[model samples]
Target chain A: MSDKSITRRDFLVKTAQGASLAVTGGLLWAYLVRQEAKAQPYALRPPGALAEMDFNAACIKCGQCVNACPPDILKLAPAGANLPIGTPYFEPRTGACIMCPDIPCLIACPTGALAPELKDINKARMGLAVIDIENCLSWKGLRCEVCHRDCPLKGKAITLETDPRGLSKHAVFRPMVNSDYCTGCGICEKACPTEVAAIRILPPALVQGKIGDHYRLGWTFDTEITQDFKPSEQAPPAPETSGGKPAGMDYLNDGGGL
Target chain B: MNTPADLSHSKLVSRPLGARLWSWRYVVLRRLSQFGILLLFFGTAHWAWEWPAKTPLLTGNLSASELFGRIPMADPFAVLQIFLSGHVLQQKVILGAAIVLGFYLLVGGRVFCAWACPVNMVTDLAGWLRARLPIPAMFVVSRNIRYFVLAASLVLSALTGLAAFEWVSPVGMMHREIIFGLGAGAMALTAIFLFDLLILKNGWCGHLCPLGGFWSLVGRTALVRVRFDKTTCTHCGECARVCPEPQVLNLKRLEETGFVTSGECSNCGRCSPLCPEGSLAFDLRPLIRKHGAEGSISSVRRTK
Candidate 1:
C-alpha cells in the first residue's frame, strides 16, 4: 500500500471538498426546508419564557426543564416530531404545567430562554384558554363547571357566568375566561371532561386579538365638546301651520300660533 | 505447533486480562465509565418512574448533569449553543463547561466520543456484528466529512436560530430514549445505527457526527496522545485493521514523527493493545514541547 501523507496540497484539497459539501448542504436546507415549512403554533413554553421568537432562538435544547418538572409534563421536542426539536413543550390535554411556586423550569434553564426575572409564575402567558361554547356541556344546559373549578387562578382567571339565554328555572352556568388574570397554564384546558375539550389552550399568538388602530368610540373622543351644541342649520323647517286649525283655536286670538 | 515453553510465553503476552492488564487499562476504564455514566442517568429514570413523586436519585439527563448534589457538568456543544444564541449565559453553565473542557484538554477531547457518547457504544456493537456477519461496507466517506457536518450544523443553527443538531443528535437521542422513553428518539437511534452499520463503516462517529468532529478539533493539541515507536515495529499492520479512524494511522508518518499527530485520532489505545510488538503506547506531553525531535524520541523510549 502507498504511504499516503497529508501534504499541504492534500489539506487544501480536503478543505475545498469540505467547503463544497457545506455550501451544498446549506443550499439544500434553504431550498427544501424553508420552502415547505409551515408555521407551528407556538408550544406551551415553561414559565418565564421569552416571547416565542426569542425563546426559539435562546433555548439550547437541553432537557433541564423536563427533568425539573415535578409533574413531568414538560418534554423536549423529539427529532422529526411535529414540533421543532429539542425545545421544551407540553400538550395541555395530555398534561399541563402545574405552575410550580418557585418555577423550577426557569431556574433550571442555563440560558435565559426562560427568564429568571419571571419570579411570579402567575405572570406567565403560555397560551390563552378559549372555551368552545358550542361544544361546552354547560352551554348545552347540563351543569359543568370543571374548567372554572380546575383553573389555577380559580375565580380570577375563570369564572362561571350564568347563561343569559337560559330559562330562569334552569340557568346554564357558562365558564368565562378572563384574559387579564389567566396565565394560560392550561390546567383548565387539561381538566375539561369533554372528549374534545370545551376549553383548549391556544398559543398567545393565535388567541390574542390585534386591536384596530382606526376604531375610536365617539364618546371617548374630545371632538364632542369642540362641535356646536346647537341644532344644525340644516334642521327641517317647522311644518307649515296646519290648514285646518280648530275653530276654537282660531278664536283664541291674536298674538301667535301655538 | 509450538513447544510448551513457546505456548506459555505466547499465553503470557496474550493473556487478554492477566499479565497485560496495563495494556488494556484505559480501555477498561473507558468501558467502566461509559457503563457507569449510562447507569447513573437511567437509574434515576427507573427510580423516578417507580416513585413518580420522590426520586432518591439526582435529577438530570445526559445533555447536562448535576451529579452528587450540585456538581454540574455540561456538554461543550450545548454550551456552544448557548453562547451563539444570544441568550444570557448563566455562571453555572460557563463553570460547568470550563470544568468539562479542562478535563478533555488534559486527557483527550475525543475521549468523550470513545467513553461517554452512548451512540458510540451502540455503533461499536453494530460494527462488531457487521464484522462477524456477511456484510459489506456500502461506501467509503472521507473522515473530513464530519468537519463539514460540524460547519453546516452551525450554519443551520444560525439560519434557524436554535441548536439544530441537538434536536436530532443520535447521541442525545439514545440517551433520551433510555431515560425519557421517547419513541421518536428510539427511532432516530435505530436509524443512525443502521446507517453506520450498513451504509459506511463507522459512518456516524467518523464521518457524520458534528459533536465528534468538534471534539477532534478541540483535541488537536491534547496532552495525552498515542506514541508510536519505529524501532520496535514489525510492520504487522494489525493496528490499522482494528482502528476506527484508520486514516489517522500512517506508517510512514509514524516512522517520521514517532507519534500519531492526527487531530482525528481518538487516543482510544486500540492500536497499543493490538500491536503484536508492543510498539505503540499512550504518553503524556506538554503542549509547547510537542513535535521536537528529541522530545518525540524520548517519549517513544519512555513508552518502551
Candidate 2:
C-alpha cells in the first residue's frame, strides 16, 4: 500500500509542481493562440466577412461558407498553411470569387463571421486590386486593359485614363481602380495576362492609405473645411515708439529678440 | 484469480470464427459509425451528392454542418466556447447546437467521442498496438487532469475572446482536414498516436482532451448505461483490461449502483461483449434499478 500521510515538505513540493505545470502549460497555450491569431492579415476572406479581429473571434471554422460557394473558390486553411487554421480563404491566381449574385456564402455562415447585413454582393470589399505599374502591359504603352474590361463593375470599379505619348499620336489607356466601387473580387487579378499577375488583390488594410482629417483639398467641389484660418480685419494698435525708435525696433537694438 | 491472458487464450481457442467475430460486434459497429460519418461528409462536399430536392446531402464538417441544405447540426462544445468568447451566434447554428446537445443528453454525451470522433480511430489503433507491443509507460498523470483542462479551456475562451481550444484542437484539425483536404493537421494525429502508443496508454482521450472531458460531464444523466449483475460476475478481470477507463468498472461501486454510474464511461461497448460470465450488458438507466431489485429477491429465494 502507498503511504497515505503527507509531510509539510511533500505538500509544498506537490503544490509547487502542480502550480508550475499549470503555469507553464497555460503560457505555452496562450503563446500558440497569440501566434495563430496574428496570422489573419495574409488571408483574403469571403464576401461579407467580418473585420479581421471580429472574424477571428467569430469564425467557428466550419467551412459552411466554403461549401456554399458556387465557384468552389474558398478553402479552409489547413494546419501548417500559415493562415488561421480551418478559416476559409481563397487564392485569386488559381480561383477568384465569382461574386455570386445570390450571395450564398454569406447566407451560409452560421456564426455571423460573414455579416448578414450585407445584402448585395457588389458591396463586398474582399481586397483591393493593386497594380505593379512597371510590369503592367498597359503602363508599358500597350493596349492591354484586361482588368478594366473584365471587372464586374467595369466602368465604375476600374476606369481607363488615356495618357497621350509625347511627339506621337499613340496614347496609353491606363487602368485605375476606384476604391468606392471595387469589390476586390479578384477577377481583375485573374484576368491579368502577365506571366506573374501584374494586378493582384491585397487586403485593403495593407494597400490603402488614409489622408487624415487635418489636410483637406480646398479645390475640390465639396470640401468640408470646418474653420479656415484668417487674419484679423483690424490690426492691433502699434507698440509705442521708444526713444523715437521704429515700432518693434527696441527689442532688436536691446539684443532681446535673439 | 483469472487474469486477462488466461481469459483471452482459453476463451478464443474454443470459440469458432463466427463466435470470435460476434465478440467483436460492437467494435465493428463503432468503426462503421466512425467511417460512415466521414464518408457522408466527404461525398457531399466533393462529389456533389445531393437529395432529390437538389440540396447537398451534407455541407460543412464536424465543427458544424447542415443536412440536405436545411437542418443545421453543430458541435455543442465548440459553440459553447464561441459563446463564452462573447460571440452571439446566428440562430441557425445555435439551433443546430441545441439539436445535437439534446440528442447526446438523451443517449450519452461521450457517444460523440466513441461513435463520431475521427481521432478515436487513430488513438484506438495506437492503444491496440501498445497493448501487444510491450511498450512501458513513460509516466503517469491523474485522469482528473482532463477536467482541469476543460475548465481552463472555458476560462481561456472568456479571457482571449476567441474559441481558445477550437483554434488549436487536434480533434477539429483531423476531422476538418480529412473532409476538406489534408495538411499539417496529420502531424497532430501522428503526435497523439505516438503519445498514446509510447508515452502513455489512452493518454489523449482519457487524460488530456477537454472535448472528451466536456462530454464526460454531460454523460452523467444519460439514459443508456452498462448494467452490472453482481451474482453472475466471475471477477475474471477481462473487461477492466480492455476498458479504456477501467476505474468505471470498480465492482463495489457497480454492486451498489447496479450500473456504471460514472460519467466517464463512454458507452463504447467494449466491456459488455467481452464479459465472460455474461454479467455486464447495456440497459436503460430506469430499468437498471428494477432489475437490481429483482436480482436481489431471486438471490434471497435461492439461498432459502
Candidate 3:
C-alpha cells in the first residue's frame, strides 16, 4: 500500500492512464456527449434533435447545435476544420439567439459540449461577433442597419442612424450599430442580405475575451469588398463538397451569372 | 501477462529455470476490446442519429415509402438473423444436434457464446464488473442448461412463429421489436436485462437464454478440456462451486474416474487457477482413458 502511495512512477502511470482515458473520453465522448447528425441549420430535424453550443472548444463537427440554434446562425467549416464533428457555427440571417432565456440549442445538444449550465444565453460562451468598420455599409457611406434591426439586443447592440440633414418627412433612414451593445449575434450578417455582406460575423477570436466572462462585442476595421450587389436568388450558390448536394444545402453550379 | 500454457506434450520433464525465463509483452488485450467497443458505441450512436435525417431508400425488405405495407422478412428470427424460423420441437431437435456437434466435432460451442446471442456479451461484461463488487461470490451454473436453453429457445421461437408459445422466445422479441420496427418495445428488453444483470449474475446466459443451451451440449465432447489431478486436490471445492457451467467435470475423481464431458463446456478454465494444488490442467487429451465406462455420455442435462 505504501509503494502504491504517491510516487513519481505512480504519477507517470496515472498520467498515462489519464491521457489514455482522455483520448478514450474524446472518442467515447460521442456517446456520453450525445453528438448527433446535423444537417444545415435551415433543414428540419427528424423530430427528436435538440440544439446546443460547443462550450469546451467551440469546434465540434456534429452540427446538431448549429441546426437547433434558434437563429440558424451556425455553419460548419467546409469539410475538415480542427473543430469537433458536432461543433456549432453561427449564421446571422435566420434569427439571432434572442438571448432567449430558454437557450433551445444548448438543450438540444446531446453533449454538454454546447451547453453551459449558466442560466442565460447572455451568459453562455458562444463567441461574440463585432462589426468591422471597413466592412460596415454605414462606414462606407451606404444604407445599412440589417445588423441593428435583426439583433435581439436591439437598441443595446445597435442604434438608429438619424438623417443629419433632415432630408425627408419621416424618421431618419440612417441605421447604425452600437459598438458597445452588440453581442456579435451575426443576425445582422444573415439579415444584411448584402452581395458581399457589408457587415459580417467572424469567429470570437476577432476580439480577445476575458476568461470566465463573455468578451463584449466590438467592431473594428476589417474588410475588402470587391463584388457588385445582387439578390440572394441571383447570387450563385456556394460551392459544395464533391459528394452529392449536402444534406440541407443547394449545390452551386458553374452556370454563368444568374 | 502472457498465458503460462504449455503447448508441448513433452513437458513431462522439469525445465531449467534459466531457459524458462523470458519476459513477455503485456499488450493490454482489453485496450483493443475498449477500442473496438468505443468505435461501435460512437459509430452506432452517431450513425443512428443520422438515420432519421435522411429518408432511407431501403430499410431491409421494406421500401422507404412503403412504411405501411408488407415486409419481406419481418419475422423475429429474420430480424435477429439467428436461427431459421419455423417450429419449436424441430428447433429442439436442431439445438440438440448442434450441442452434440460442438462437443464431438467443432471444439466448443463458441458460436452460441460469441456471435448469435447478445445476452452472452452482456453477461461477460457483467462478470468483469462483478470482480470489483462487495457482493457475494459468483456461482457457476451447470453447463447442461446451455443446450437446454438453446433447445427451449428454438422450440419456443418456432412455437411463437406458429402462434402457440409466444412468451418463451427472446429471439422473436429481439427480431420483431428491435430489428423490424426498431426502438419498439425496447422497454421490455431493457427491463429484462436489468433484472438479469442486477438480480442474478449472468442470469440470461446462465439461466434464461436458450441459445446457451445449445452451446453447452456442444462443448461436452470437446477434444480439449480441463482435467484435474486429484492427488493435488485439497478438495477445496472452489472448482465445483465457481464452475460457470455445471457438469464440467467431477472434482473428486477427475484423474481416476474422469468427469462427464459433452459439447456444452465452454473450456473457460475457471477451475484451473482456483485450485491451490494446481492439480487442474486444461489438457488436450481425454480426462478418463476409460472406454470401459458404459454410460451413454450425456451431452446435456438429460433429466438428471
Using TM-score, give the best candidate's number.
Answer: 2
Which residue pairs show backbone clashes in model 1? none
Candidate 3 reaches a DockQ of: 0.01
- Docking class for model 2 is medium
Candidate order, TM-score descending: 2, 1, 3
Fraction of native contacts, model 3:
0.00
Q: Report every candidate's CA lDDT.
A: 0.73, 0.87, 0.42
Candidate 2: fnat, from 0 to 1? 0.74
Which residue pairs collide in model 2, if any? none
Best by lDDT: 2
User: What's the ranking of the predictions by DockQ, best on top?
Assistant: 2, 1, 3
Error of 2 at A233 (Å): 10
What digit string (tens of lDDT, one per residue) describes model 2 on residues B149-265?
A: 998888888888888899999999998998889999999999999999999899999899999999999999999998898886657777898999999999999988899988888
What is the lDDT ranking, best to worst?
2, 1, 3
Candidate 3 per-residue C-alpha lDDT over B77-149 given as tens digits, one digit per residue, 9 for 90 to 100: 2222123223122232233333334333445553334333443444556655664565563565543444444
Q: What is the interface RMSD of candidate 2, in Å?
A: 0.9
